[model samples]
Target: MSELDHASDPVVGASSRRDLFKLAGAGVGLAAAAALPLVPATAFAATPRFRLGEPEPAFILDPDVLYMNIGTTGSTPKYILKQFNDDNREVATNPTQSFGGVTPFRTLAAPGFGAELEEFVISYNTTDGMNKILAGVELNSGDEIITTNHEHPGGNGPMNLLLQRRGVKITRVNLPVGNNQKAQDYVDLFKAAITNKTKAFVFSAPTYLTGTMLPYKRLAKLAQKNGIMTIVDGAHATGMFNLDFQQTGIDFWGCSGHKWQCGPGGTGVLYIRNRVTKANPLPLFNFWPTNTNNSTLIEPRTNANAETYNIGTAVQSIGNPNYPMLKAFAECCTFWDSIGRGVIEKHDLTLSLYLKQKIASVWSVDNLYSPKDDPELLSALTSFSPFHTSSASVALGQAATDETAQSTTFVTRMREEYGIVIRNTAVPVIGSPAPHHPMRISTHLFHSARDVDRLVRSMKDLASRMDAGA
Candidate 1:
């Protein structure tokens, strides 16, 4: 059957994608997809039990525009916003000192993320966390760290800094895109690059550019087998996925609280594996507290059975803290807990799946930058080239500048004319002379099937007009 025919198939039709997503917003299928071991089962739920757009009232976004850029940043929920405001006022009025390293907030928020109180640190942001992880990890000269080419500046910056400061060798695996890829494909790519010199595996989960959710558990397992530390740029995973740090066997994770988590800006969650896990029975690697005030109080874990120090406390105690913002961030975690992360993830992924199906129906799957067929690769972010019928058409080196301009125009028109807020990304297509510019859309709990329909309609109309030189 044709791609369009398949997308509209009654078994997983447009109506079911929309209606089932709405109804299942509460909690229907928490079982993980058999194919995608890391993802929660609700992601594949055929029938949902709650309303899709019921959480719209929780956020205080601009009504004039449909904000679909949560991949970059999320709007704070109304209740959290109020708490942030009240906390700020109280802090300003009382003039208190933040000597305890935001322990109260960390204590309340750590368990939800599958982290111990001493393992979680409230960071300034993902960049801050990434920097701390890279700087603190004991990478000596000639030590190798394997990463991906599609990595954001957040991950790239720290890795690059390591190259300059510590003389660490960086290896990048070119990621494969589109419907034909599988989760194991990523593991195989990373596995091939591993060597005795390799000390760590660093990459993003649900890369911001293509919105591909890399199989973390599989990758972590691969790293663990090789006796390598795993450092994750989880900017999009914190609020989007119901992640368990210990379960994933990651040594270090830095995720943005402001993005999918809907917390205040400059707030993030950093997880450090201070104890041994079944996945990684090796002793913890030696790490220093580079960005902390209590460096003397922290030490590397030597035992596989117990933590050597409170790494979170050492890292989080960087002078006076942003009390109000951290408090608000903690409250935001509570808010997500109340709604259930699995339910939110199911809704978000369902909307994205609906959007991808619609885009495939019109543009064909060949133009998609994000994988649609692989459940493990699915994420709330969907990216595609609207102007081209196939990605291969833009593989030639000469179209990069034109494609970028066209993508920017598409994004601007989508926001200015259609009242939809989305962003475009420069994707590095394999074998291409230059990057392919594709627009990205973020689907979250507040979005619905109707929203996806509207976006597709607007995209179709806008692309048609742009093609006609209007």
Candidate 2:
């Protein structure tokens, strides 16, 4: 099918490359650009006056869909999309300068893109980047790394892989759900868990399940004291929150750009401190091992399996990355900076608090899993549970319940029956053993008070229907 036809088709979700290139082509041909159907594309370029009850920022995303689930995958604005297209076109037209030339495009990207190329910041998907950090580092057998129950399965699988393949030991530190425990309790627990055998410490900087911000500053100090290299699986920490990995003093960190950072898919960031340069031994691409005392020299000497985590030629030749998207993410950073961390934090909390209040007012709502309105603990995402319901009864088990299955049905019902696109978190719900909860929702810059109102209205309707046996 043609690109326009595909985009126009209700059955086909998200726009395609043909559509993206067509949009780019229009811009190149000034006459054609004016004719391309721009989806509220002008608002992005103009300075929007932030007014109460004003329509939320609509960034070339599908206006037909109420995408409250920015946490899952962010919607890139047209300005950024245009930049990506232009960059890609430039690469296609001038391969020598763009990819093969002395001034390679990727090299330009290294300065501002993410972690510097000289550093261990390799660009890959979330799991790919995490695997690089996990595989590159040396872990002595029987060394222990402390983690938590509240993590995505992507993270869980990797930790387990390390344990199964490398003889590393994982110590899970469980945090209390809801009001069961305070934030300091978690910090103390992690500190208490550390032992001489602890080589690395890993945890989600922000607890994925509850969006509870972990005390990284405090934890970093502790990790440093114990001489344990810290690897934080901060998939959700990037876009939704401001991060200064250097300031955090952690040895290594990995995060996805799509979640809150709103960068395109297959984009992520990894950071390794300069201190780890000499101390931390990383695997090499085409690594050759040597009997030399120097760790850096050992990679050249050891040649068994050096190609494991290298970006290699496979990723290097994929043309210049969606330059516009990278530019857009930089713009998103600019946008975040202008809004100020305090304001963004306040905006997210306002929506979450509003949702929490609405849910609390409902007769059937039982437990709200998000942090209790504390700015230090809260984030853009919230997960909650509905009590006195048939679905909840069937799903909740003594050990753990599959929040993914339950939330899928709820969110699907919300979207198909109503017009909402909330996310279902795969992070273990507070007080639950499993790594998923029945319902999870995300609020972003695009979401407005009205959207929250719509959610509140639908939730009340759902509760009433359930109560009435419908």
Candidate 3:
């Protein structure tokens, strides 16, 4: 097969002897392939190239922990981790070449993502990318930016800052808290939000909190109709979904490689729509002077103000960035692509649906979240309220009882006593002064049918135990 063909093959697991032979052959040009010896007939063909279901060595996870928190941050696999380590080791051996060579860390980062060497700008994390877009954007006071109330604080806080500090106004569209919202529903809401004062329309492709997937293509087109810029906060989309920016045509995107993409913690990506970057008055790539008292003012002052804001110089010093981690991020994409996004999505939803079903049947839990078959409307995670009203009330009211608590005593009992890791969220209840709802749960690729079974069993045990004692 051609090198390009080899490039596209799914890397399932460890490298094969034949793969090694071919790799060695490529080293010597045309003559190497001719000189290579034939492989033994008994040797198994390269292990199906590390796809999902294959257990990979973990970087930071404890052997005993069942980590369902990939939604918060993912653990790096072994192969890409080796690359990150090697890169750091090389830097330690020859720090000058690694950090200040012809291709600086920022410049070296570009071609890795198949974009131009100049377009790649590295940030500390997803929030760093958000700040970059806000800092680099040129918006006048009273110009409105539309986003969602479903957004994580990472995006929401920045929008609030713009509202408070820059005099810009923000319009947050409230989404249906439960059930599958139709695609047209999103298009209509965006249409209603756009106006002459609308400068930008920013939202997540699949939001972190609610797990609602936006109609990105329609949103992109709507923004274009009103000459508004589109900024997508895709902290959950990178590895969790198949993302083709060219297909969506969004203006600006902020994604964290760590969450679903399973990259390093400090790894995140921001893409500026080529056309918007070209025409906008905001400087996309200039460097600010060290003498700046008001650095924020200088960035949005022009389009070419400082490339530094787009690409920070201090990444190497802070994280020393595991190079292998970046490669692993790419490899993780490759691995997900190998299984096919359609397949992974289907698998995740299947597991999620089964989980939801079992939770309903066994525990009588209320999945006040999403419906089955509307996979696009949700991710692997499913949030739920308890089946019993009193249980939920106690869960919600626990905070009032202890002002200085990390979480409720109920949650503490679950983790310390029950060995389960579930998330607690505060949602709105009708007629309540403060709308903090009960807890939610997250499901992911690493979870098995048995995991859901256990969850169902545990909830059943807890509910029964609570009722019997009462």
Candidate 4:
């Protein structure tokens, strides 16, 4: 080969994999430092081309701890965190230089979330948005709002408050558990619960309890058919699902940016269908907080378009909020967008499927808590029982509690002994008297097949060592 041809080859010419790792460690632009062409984030996307656990200079998760709990929280990328620290330092020194949340990030983030520019707001986690919307809603004594059993405190907290203060009745559908159910079952369960007294249908898409992605389109159809408003607790859906608020026709959705989006804590995205459209035109009760410019006006809120009024500002612009944190969130979303949402979803879903298979192979399919067969019911979260169960059935109540405790203990052992981080969710079985505590695992772009295998093997060994036996 000619000397010129040899010089141009990135692999053979000075820039080797070892040099690339060193460049990643350097405190500068990694691509530039390595003298390699900068590739878009989309280059690492789906189609199974890039191997898992591939070197990403941007991410800095600990190599020792196998973090399988992105469902609980995610590690921020090094670049974003560096900027966050720098911005915080700048504002700290000046003490008044930061801008409000809206203008800085509005245009850059809107398209990525499929939200109109005015509708998106960087709020404090999923619960913060839930509280704001719940307070803004109008209800009277005995008025009913529908939700499922799988809701977290963020969604349930406000509803519970209303139940105590205003006597609004919060009815819950006992969502069916296990992989035996179908998507239509969800529609039927929710449809059966709707009555003329029902004012709102609130539920989680892929609930935190079981990682079940309830059919939002079908459920929203039911809400629309009956003239009921819809509120979705989408804590785990933000970075995992390809969200299109207008198309889904859900009136509201609140999700955490930290969980799968890999943004900082206290950051999240809330989508409010601001305009009156064929999809959702129901007049909403408006309450502008004192933090926003809207607070000064005595005039009732009016709209130029669905997005004319930025209701999210009520939650976002409250008393000199974290400007640097909001900006970091915008960067995180841009990173996701450049990679392409469809590609990320596909890759995450693949890891989830692989983990589910590995778990089922050892524990048996019947032991799986999260759905396995339904394509529509998948997420990056997987849950299953990894405790000791006797061949002979144990007595119902206290025995159930004992077993669930073991499941919880098993999770602790995985972290302490195996250096694997995961979580446990206690869910109610159809006939069981007590809640079933299953180990929950979240797989993301950072995980590889080796990670999954090691995680599964570690879990298996730990279960035996702990003797999950009741």
Per-model TM-score on C-alpha atoms? 0.88, 0.71, 0.70, 0.84
Q: What are the runs in model 1 whose C-alpha is more than 4 Å off?
A: 1-52, 97-101, 295-297, 393-398
**Of candidates 3 and 1, the better by lDDT:** 1
Write model 2 residue lDDT over 1-470, tens digit each, in one string: 10111223222112332343344341133233223332232322234533212223426656666777766777665555667677667767875433333123334433332333433343555676566667667775797878887766667787888799988899988765552345677779898898888877778767666667676766777776677677788787776655655556666777776776666666766564432322233322221111112232222323222323333222322344554444445555555444443334434544555565566556333466665434456556766765322123233564344444445667777788777787655544444334545466887655665677688788668646654766
lDDT tens digits by residue: candidate 1, 1-470? 11111122223211222344343331222222111111233332432322345344567678888899999899888877886787777778887744244788999889889899878999988999999999998998999999999998988998998899889999999998777798999999999999899999999998988999999889988888888999999999998887778888888999999999989999999998888868667788887888877748554476665677787888888888888888889988877775577666765776677677777778888888898776678888998888763346464544767777888988999999999999988888787777877889998877766677788899999999998999
Question: For model 1, what is the C-alpha lDDT against the true structure?
Answer: 0.79
lDDT score at residue 368, model 1, on the 0-100 scale:
84
> Which ranges of candidate 4 are over 4 A from the true structure?
1-52, 99-101, 278-293, 298-306, 388-397, 468-470
Model 4 lDDT tens row, 1-470: 10111133332111222233343332232222223222333344432223234425667877778889998999887888999999999899988877554566756777877788667777789998788777766777988999988899999999999899999999999887666778889889888988878988889987898888888888888888888888898999888876767777787888888998889999888777777666655554354443354554434555434454555555465677678888888888887776666555655665566666666678776667778566677777887876632122334778976876787788887888889999988776665566777888897767765677789899888877777442
Cα lDDT of model 3 by residue, 1-470, tens digit? 11111223343232322243344343233233322222221221332443232233334455454455566787766666777777778767876533333225445444333333334444446787776676666676999998876677778777888888989989877665555356678889878877789988889877665456777877877776677777888787666655555446576677787776677777776665432332243323222223223334433323442342332332222333454445545555555554455444433444555555555555443455443334346566665544333123333355544421333444454566667766655544333334444445655545555556666676567656655752
- Give residue 456's error in model 1 in angstroms: 0.6
lDDT agreement of model 4 with the native: 0.72
Worst 10 residues of 1 by lDDT: 30-39
Worst window of 10 by summed lDDT in candidate 4: 1-10
Q: Which stretches of candidate 3 lie over 4 Å from their true place?
A: 1-51, 54-60, 97-120, 275-342, 363-366, 371-373, 387-411, 428-432, 467-470
Q: Pick the candidate with the highest lDDT.
A: 1
lDDT of 3 at 112: 36
Estimate every model's Cα lDDT from 0 to 1.
0.79, 0.55, 0.55, 0.72
Candidate 4 C-alpha error for residue 283, in Å: 5.5
